[model samples]
Target: MPEGASHQSDSHTQREAEEEILAGLAASLGVVLAKPERVALSGGVFVEVDAATSDMGVVVEAYARQGRLKGAQPKKIAQDVLKLALLKREPGWERTRTIIAFASHEARNSISGWLARAAAEFGVELFVVEVSEELRARILDAQRRQVMANADLLADDLVVQTDSGR
Candidate 1:
């Protein structure tokens, strides 16, 4: 398969997993949650959260990776934290419950150390929603495929260069 197609497939898998996690959370919380329309912030800026209750009382950003963070994954999670924190600063969102939901404990640990403390201090709650065994297997399988793909690229003398110059 082509490299671009492979990456797109991986991304699609991750997105589906995340959507599943959000659905599980909605069931656990007994509330219907959907992505709200872009929320207005100051200066005509707007941001969107992954899911929110109809009343906007609860907002969530979910991470569905089953393993530890890799590459820019940590930064991605931090960005979610930042989004939720900024949203909370909005006038009517001050009381909104901001949560960062995780599909696995390992993914949750990506925020360990000072970042974790900072998220808590910002009133960002961390929660883990259990995914089914089959979903868990699928996530693990995708992760393994991703790792192998990276290895294969490196072995093919592709001279992979990251933007960070790593």
Candidate 2:
């Protein structure tokens, strides 16, 4: 591949990985994954969310990077900022919770402090997989909740089945 093509390929691969991770995280949190999903606002207009959960009113923009934080911080911040800006312009979308999920917090540790501050100021959440303590905790909790919910559903179905059989 040419030098430019190689770079483009890498970026595309990184984005795919990031999108997958974000989708899984969103699923764990009971959110449906739909990229560029169109949602009808209070008005007759509709808006596109990068990934949104209809039930929870949450949207996420994910970023994946393989380098040290110093080289990527500004760009990542800019991307998050832009996403936030677009979401906020939609009438009711501003009320929707926004998140910027990174692939790994440690990968961005060099600018972790700055990211936290910027995310907060921008009214968007910042989370990472396999790195941030908070992200792990949230994932674990969501998993537990999902399992318990499934158990309940299964039990209820079993009871209904037995009663009908009798």
Candidate 3:
């Protein structure tokens, strides 16, 4: 009902979908994965991957959108690639298998350009897993709701500007 409430709800929904996709990927890969502790980076920096094996052998970053990415979504994929690449640079993770999993073909295709190529060159595998129709529908609905919420917020801002004679 309030501004940003829908976004918060949509974010929760997307996170749930991402967890499901990660589980499916772990099952398909025959490897157990969990959110690992903050991985060390240079200069005492740290980062976390969505999932990884106990040995840090298999690391993953998952995206759970149902359709083509919009706005800054592509940047998120790029950030994932960078995270995996940085992880690879860490000792003992040089040989780790890194992945970026998607929940839909359309979402994957949205980055099938230079970003995809960069990911491949960085050794970040991209995959599309088959999710339940219900889950897919839920994600789509969330997307629609988020869009409408954004539009409503914009309209509200315009009304405030008009009232203020701006």
Reference-based lDDT, each prediction: 0.85, 0.61, 0.87
Question: Which clashing pairs does model 1 show?
Answer: none
List TM-scores for all candidates, in order. Answer: 0.84, 0.55, 0.89
Candidate that would win on lDDT: 3
- Candidate 1 lDDT, 19-94, residue by residue in tens: 9889998998898999888777898998888889989899999888897888998888888888899989888889
Compute the lDDT of residue 44 as modeled in candidate 1: 94
Candidate 3 C-alpha lDDT tens digits along 1-166: 7866555235778888888999899899999989988777877898888888998889899899888899999999999999898888877778989999999999988987789889988899989888899888888888888888788988999999999995
- The best-first sequence of candidates by TM-score reads 3, 1, 2
Candidate 2 per-residue lDDT, tens place, 1-166, comes to 6655432122445545656667667766766756765656555766554576755377777655433455446676667655665666676566778876666665445444655576677687766644344544544454355456667888999999999998
TM-score of 2: 0.55
Comparing 1 and 2 by lDDT, which wins?
1
Compute the lDDT of residue 160 as modeled in candidate 3.
Answer: 97
Model 1 reaches what TM-score against the true structure? 0.84
Per-residue error at 81 for model 1, in Å? Answer: 0.9
Error of 2 at 140 (Å): 26
**RMSD to native for every prediction?**
4.1, 19.3, 2.6
Pitting candidate 2 against candidate 3, the one with the higher lDDT is 3
In candidate 2, what residue range of length 10 has the lowest lDDT sum? 5-14
